[model samples]
Target: MPLPEFNLYPDFNTVRLSHAYLNVSDLAASKAFYCDTLGLQITDESETHVYLRAMEERGHHCLVLQKSDAPGTVDAVGFKTYDEADLDRAEAWFQAQGRPTQWVIRPYQGRTLLTSDNLGIPLEFYHKMDRLPSIHQKYALYNGVKPLRIDHFNCFSPDVDASVAFYNSMGFRVTEYTEDEDSKRLWAAWMHRKGGVHDMAFTNGTGPRLHHVAFWVPTPLNIIDLLDLMATTGYVDNIERGPGRHGISNAFFLYVLDPDGHRIEIYCSDYQTVDPDLEPIKWDLTDPQRQTLWGAPAPKSWFEHGTRFTDAETRDSDIAASPIIAP
Candidate 1:
């Protein structure tokens, strides 16, 4: 069968990737990593879930982590289209593909569609959402550097090429890639959707899993503030790597993990690629600089450990691919 094409039906006019949900084993540790280390504010919370947002965004939440007893995984990811028309079109397109999706009504968020992806990750699409009424008054004091909102997520899959193909068919662009000695394998690729590179990305790994959730800060200085905040909060040990630049997006970055070992990345000043004619870049796996232009190698856990998510068994056939291979 041909790959499923991403069709933003008439109603699903413009879909933008949004928040990521995580299942954490320890609520306090998870909360400290995000709030104290990463500087994301806890907008609201209940017994099961915690809603968080960047200081600059008024959205009800940008990252929602929940407390769970079982082994953790990505619970869901939120995507928003331009308007109601786009939402309708999105629903139509998914339905046409015979994918199982459901319409959901949320409190701060409006009409949303729940679906599964080829990688077995739970996904969501929305058109309208309700913002917190107090954000305007409360967040006004956020004079410190602030990021806009959550931008993209990167996942590890057994098959990098297949994962890239799946997302590309869904309208994601491969802005950058790294390939190995064997022509049959790809190591990593940065993808983009709705504008910025990487609504989500696929890295060759041992299993299907989430690598990190990235947020776009307004300026590089905000990144400094983030570092300072992390240091001041005594969350410095949570720093995975960076406060360094990357060769791919040219964006400066810093990565930190929440309580359950789920990674969250803070980033800013990535190159923009709204133009249609841009070419995708490929990197040699042998490149000495692939890991970092300057810095120690990523920890073994960084390459090996990542969170996974479950899908609705939306694919007609399963393809075997390795996300991360032993280096």
Candidate 2:
């Protein structure tokens, strides 16, 4: 099948990737890793839940860690609509597509619409999140990596082509994609609404698992600092992948497992993609440099292991190709 046409106009104006709702066994331990170590600030907290915001995010939170039986289960991935009217239209749009939709109450957010994509990945849409004062210049408050803001999410999908088409119909533009050399089918895709490289990405793998949530850092130097901190502070084993550049986005990255084993990437230095007519970059499945621009190949766990969504069933990708993996 051919690539889906990018929908420049849609029924609703969905804006950006906003937040993730995660389930963790220990709130305090997760708090130490996310706030004390990663530099996100506490927006709100209770015995059962905690909300976190990046230094540059004005919204009440970009992450929510809620107490659960264990770590590494995702509740939902969130995006913000352009306005309340858009949120209403988004609910209608999902309903019109035969996807279930519901209105739910969330703290500090207005009129949240809960639904799922074609892949059954849980998603939440809202507008009017409570705003907070910027703390970007509060240098003393900066911690481990000094993350500036939430950047994007990478999801493991059973069908990258279907995912690309589904999201494309929702007005996301494809920015980059990887295709299987033999089948010429999409193996992975990066789609954007807020116009960086991606607001979300889909990689060919098990169905509907979250690979990682990326945060924008000040520079590559911040990643170096995080490496040193994790090394001495008893989190050496948590350091999973690159302090290297990705061939796809040209992003400098470092992946670390939080206390709950959820992956988070501290990232920076990708170029802009704001122009409407920008062409999507493609990589072949067999390219040696497709996954990494430099440094060692990603470890096997990096591709195979990902956090499952609560109650979602897993499906293996129909089209598969071996990418370079560190043994």
Candidate 3:
């Protein structure tokens, strides 16, 4: 099947992927992982919550950790629109599709719209956020891999093809995708708006689980430093996979689990995909190197495990295929 046409004139303009809300078992532990180890600056914090922003991000926050008894549940992944008018347009767009939405009061954000996609992945869309001075040049404040910005989010989609088609309608273009050879179906896709590989990616797996939230780091050296830090610290066991390249995006990566088992990827070096006409790069499901161009095979947990979406109902997916896995 051919890729869907890019929606040039959608009802609203979504600028790029924004923040993610997650529930953590312990605020102190999660803080150590994100702010101390991962190099995200704590923008604000309270007794029950902490907001974090990357070094280069001017937004109030890119990730929010909420202390909860039921840890490992993701509240929502988010995106930003062009302006307040676009937020209004977005509300109409979702309402047109009969998707329920709510205007919620969020700290440091203006008029947040809480909604979901056709697959029921919880999403938050907003246009306004408080800004902060850049701390990119603050050498002394740097810690762990020194992540520069939020890169993308990958989700476990029960139906990859459907996920691609749906996001395609919202103006997210396909940069690359993995195909199921026997079925000739899309097994995974890297869809983007901000253009460095992907702002979002979907992998066929169980329904509505977040595969990993990725952050762009300075270089491959950062991954090496992070590995050393994890080994010396108490988090050597948190390394899930990588310190390798992905054939699909050509990005070097390292995946680690947070205290709550929420997956985080330190990534860099993916090529651009800004041109709307750019054809999608395709990989067969059977390609071993597609996942790791050079490294040990990914553990089974990398494929089968992910952060569950809060209050989202799960269902079995109809499409099925067997792909390569680590022994």
Q: Which ranges in model 2 have alpha carbons more than 4 Å from their true place? A: none
lDDT by residue (1-327, candidate 1, tens digit) is 122233323324445677877888878877767775565778888878888887667678888888887546787788877777766776776777566688876657888888766666777888766676555346554543355678888877666777777566566767778866555466788877667777787766655677888988777777788778777766678677777776667787888766677787878777777765677777666564565556345566777677777432222212333222224
Clashes of each: 25, 0, 0
lDDT by residue (1-327, candidate 2, tens digit) is 568877899899889999999999999999999988898999899999999998888899999999998578999999999988998889889999899899999989999999999989999999899999988888898887998999999999998988998999999999999988788889899999998999999988998999999999998999999999989988999999878999999989999999888999999999899998999998877776778887468899998889999878889987757787888
What TM-score does each of the candidates earn? 0.82, 0.98, 0.98
Model 1: worst 10 consecutive residues (lDDT sum): 312-321
Give candidate 2's error at residue 281 in angstroms: 0.6
Query: What CA RMSD would candidate 3 show?
Result: 1.1
Candidate with better lDDT, 1 vs 3: 3
Q: lDDT (0-100) at residue 73 of candidate 1?
A: 78
Q: Summarize candidate 3's per-residue lDDT along 121-203 as a digit string, tens digits.
A: 98899999999998999888889999899999999888888888889878888888887777778888999888778999998
Number of the top lDDT candidate: 2
Global CA lDDT of candidate 1, please?
0.70
RMSD of each: 4.4, 1.0, 1.1
